[model samples]
Target: MKSNPSTDPPAEFLARMSALLPAAEFAAFLAAFDRPARVGLRVNTLKISVPDFISIAPFSLAPLGDWEPAGFLVTDDSRPGRHPYHDAGLYYLQEPSAMVAAALLAAAPGERVLDLAAAPGGKATHLLSRMAGPLPDAPLSALRRGLSSGGLLVANDVHGGRARLLADNLARWGAVNALVTQAEPAHLAASFGPVFDRVLIDAPCSGEGMLRRGEPVEWSAAIVAACARRQRGILAHAPQLARPGGRLLYSTCTFAPEENEAVIAAFLAGAPDFTVIEPARHAAFERGRPDWSAAPPAIADQLARAVRLWPHRFPGEGHFMALLGRDGEPGDEATRVAPFRRVPPSGEQWRLWRDFAEASLTVALPEERIHAHNDRLYLLPAAAVAVERLRIVRYGLLLGEMRPGRFQPAPDLALALRAGDATAALDLWPDDPQLAAYMSGAELLQAGADGWVLVAVAGFGLGWAKRAAGRLKNHYPRGWRRG
Candidate 1:
């Protein structure tokens, strides 16, 4: 039975939306939207085991109805802000509906992938975690070859600040196989034409799904029309960047058809060889609404292939996704420039930093990967090369170690790692007292056995350090540290 329109919406919002969609349908949607869904998050497998993470979390971690095992429905509660696990990087705060796009792009280990707008690093981290463990030696070799030569993910964000934030998230998740680039869609397409195996186009859109978050958009015809134009602009070049037979997962957080089905229709109409992959592969997936489907030659069947998550139907923000792939394209087998450069370290500075780190922490770091750049010695992935040509915003520093002959990581590397580098330091766990001190601007002496203790807010790895006897000095930059 059709629901009554007036029964569902606030009198004011209904008045505005009445002219937009069918009054009855708009009312039903508002009725659903009013009761915003609970928060959800995906556990980072690269950091901690799911069971171990849940056990340590202060809040209840319920399994999500539709997402994978690592995904959970994080209940909306007063404790979200105060929770120590959050500070520790135990999990990423993401909506359940948003997980669909990333989970869809979970390629086999070593597949060359791209996250076109991978800022704030949520989906990028998820993809890397899936690529771990033993893989076909050839693909694994290709993947590592790319990592050594810097051929893995090119996580690009146009914004400078957000790009740094993305790097931090990826590093904390212990990613060591990615390259961070800052460029626009057109720029990327021109540089690496049709080379990626998988591409995630989580495009920007009007904040329709964020109505509960106080998005200030008015439900007007002009607003929707404008957003539709923008969505088309963002997705127009997506196919150009995707290799033939490769997957392009397009997604948006907004519920508007202009940004969802309409955008997909436009892309399909322009790109002839691409066909949409069905979402039916997922056990609980639901097809997109038919009434919103576009005209012929517009991939109408593909609309059915798309997945939709209405706020009322799912415990998350509204989202839509379509996985499209091109047929009959030759496989990618391109080689890349080597990623390593035999740059020597400044012996005196290297020794000074090493001495400080060894006496302060418990873990041991390899010395070969440590080198000097711009007179500042940095501990980087041994494979990283020729970063000077690119405008490098941040390359993580390798601080000293705990015991003599052993090295530890510095906490600040969270703000400075590429995806494929093996920057994971053993012995650091979220909630270690040293981590809290680091977050609060304190430099700490190693106090644990073997002098190895994890420094983190939750369970995420920030960096490693050595134990010392002097009063701990705070390294937290005044601008970045929160009280």
Candidate 2:
């Protein structure tokens, strides 16, 4: 069941943990790796409701824990990752413990949120869903209204490749009110000062949780020390992005006390304006050990307010989360730093995009906020903040390319829409042969008028196809095609 057989605990790691854990708890923690790691998935509530997804679930799925509302545990050997439902963005395969971070942050509607280290966007997607508030009904007309409620998520990662993957994941989640950015923490702080309502730092740390992945991780005191140093450095610039009374959450997958308590302790010591807020408690959650570090006497007790998810106790990989609140009440919106943004011209840019939307979509596009970068057109979120010179992977909903006299829609534009939004959609069951054909980049014969068509799997947008002369040509991205 494990990816590698070298998951046996390192002697030094065992020795260190033996000193840290009590006899019975240490035995359980050691035994947890011997069992197969359970697979977990969080439903994309933006696309489908949890109950509806549960009614049609293809596998043995159960609630993950009390930790996350949308989180579920997959008890079967079924590879949901390889299924069409996953491709259609019904649920995301995530470690159950990883879901605990955003749950603790608890972003609300209309909040300007930031994920300081978002990549492949697990937590960022969760944040966007939470910020979406409540949905209206099943065949979602409120999806646009939910996304447009002055809410926007700034999901950033330092790596360019990871940033692109993150954008792709958010797109599949049908997240239209998000901006994907590739920039370091310091640069972000400088560009947008004291603006975000909620900020999360899922800081890079020593991979003690790699044990759950069945990967043999070389553990040492030096490795934990290096990770702690990097965490402290990145966290130093985080407070500048938080507005007064805003919440900033710090989390790590490592069990290292140095990475967890020591980093937060150090940040609090340097910055007097922030204090730890006791996280919402769960039965599986354990209190953080402030005694594990040389924390100041004043905040040492408050550090216990942080939560720890140990594999011996929680039903997933190890993770640590601590929430902090900035001093003073929430301030006015004008205090935010605006990025350099220009109005896209009305002449050539409008023609192709308008033509595509008018012909294909049943709903109206937000034309006022649509901006262009070269030939590419993007729909910006309401009240968006512009970044002058950062490497932004995505501005908003990438409407697609406006080339010559025609417009080519992005894969994202299709995913962001419901089957009802499309003028023509081919809704097929999961076992349909044409569904596999479409995902594999093969064309199909269909009864339809010639133009753009949304190929759907069980009423969910899978990708786009163009129909001409009763034949459907696959427009699904070649890179995304399944073998």
Candidate 3:
């Protein structure tokens, strides 16, 4: 493979890659390298069903040929990045090939699932859309129902900074049921042994499939072999993290057989109880090449079940996937693990906030949902276990409604609450002249004394506020205030 003169190729990268595969295979990899850099995303089911999303989207929605429900061959567009819908979380921007990995996991609502290496929230949000069900037809009715029960999607990232992005994305999408966690794979597996109904290991790989985006990678047998070793450790321990009878979907964006079929074959050999299910029956996903028998004769048959997504063949990035199912039940008679404690605020403190909240905002904070954590009060859902045992990455996880009695909608709720008759909201932004003045840490003027005003920037709602005395107190958090 010639190193293109335009790119500053890494040392021996081309030479190394050529030694690992035939010239024809190297050419195919190069041809897939021509497309643009960004990945695509489809709207989730919970926010909008596939059929409905297609009806509204200004693109021709077709079967990604290899992917299932809602997956599509999105026409390349520069607008999604700038569109309001994208900002409103109407759709997710994801790698077209990456979509296949999540769909293959086949998780559903009311089921417990874990995204072992979730960060920047691509797969986790896709899974969240599945749990939130669909919006109702009766305008305000569906809006209210959507918030009533945001299902659980425990999105975790090992790094602390990335977990914040994961939480931010989930919140931006209004999938409030999602809880963020920062933990190692081993710790998570130990805490919730065999409890996850579905687990997605979009495992870290050699980035062979990402050459186009990251610049051409110099592939070599030794590098591929090393990646295979790392893949094996994660794959071997992945089953222990899944509930007995649960599903584990392993995927990577690279084309190394060492990291793809060989890793699965090695694990299955040692763990006899798990079986490789046919991908065709589940989602009619495209299958990997069946010609590797001559090279890896021992695992030739098992390789037939693995799925591959090549950039040349599919509309997205290149990827490899295999679905494995565990045998036996998930075990019996297990007690719930109490990981979080909800200590209520003191009576005097609660009364002060409660009275202030009742008089100032349109969204009512219920006593049951309101709990003190790390010295801060948050209104969360009853089933939000992801909060327990995990550091509070983002609070106000569950969005509430503006019940009468001095309540107002949150900025996110404003878009959601817009479906119903909401009182006029104040247009403000982080740097709004009014906001800047208010942030001088002083209250600004309100037109009326004790009335509701939507706190906004431009036209987007941030939260709510009230007018008292001659000052407009910023209801936005002191912690959340612009530093």
What TM-score against the true fold does each predicted structure earn?
0.76, 0.96, 0.76
Worst 10 residues of 1 by lDDT: 137-146
- Please report how far candidate 3 places residue 97 from its true position, in Å: 0.9
Model 1 lDDT per residue over 176-243, tens place: 55667677777777666666778888887766666654445555556667878877887887776677
lDDT of 2 by residue, 1-483 (tens): 223345676668778888989988888888787777879899987777788889999999889766677899998889999999898888889888989888999999888899999998999989987888766574572236444566879999999899999999988888778899999898998888778889999998888876666776777889999999999999998777888889999999988899999899999999899999987787788999988989878889879999999887888899889999999876665254575385684577788777888888887876777888888888888757878568889888787887678898888888877788889989888999989898899999898788899888888888899999999989999988999
Q: In model 3, where do residues sit more than 4 Å from their true spots? A: 1-26, 37-39, 48-77, 139-151, 214-226, 281-285, 289-299, 333-340, 352-367, 386-483
- lDDT per residue as tens, model 3, 1-483: 344665533445546546655899767756656656544767755454566656656554456554455666556554565444454455787887788777777777676778877888888878766665555663322134345654455677878999888877776665555567787777776666666778888877877777766565666667778888987887777766777788888888887667787788788778777777776533335676546323355456767888987666666766889888888776651125444456676665465556655544455545776666544555554455533345556554533332334233344443333322334455654335776554344466766656555554434344456566645666654544544
Report how far residue 103 has shifted in candidate 3, in Å.
Answer: 1.2
Q: TM-score of predicted model 2?
A: 0.96
Model 2 lDDT at residue 453: 94
Clashes of 3: 13
Model 2 collision count = 1
Please report the candidate that would top TM-score against the real structure. 2
Report lDDT (CA) for all predictions. 0.61, 0.84, 0.62
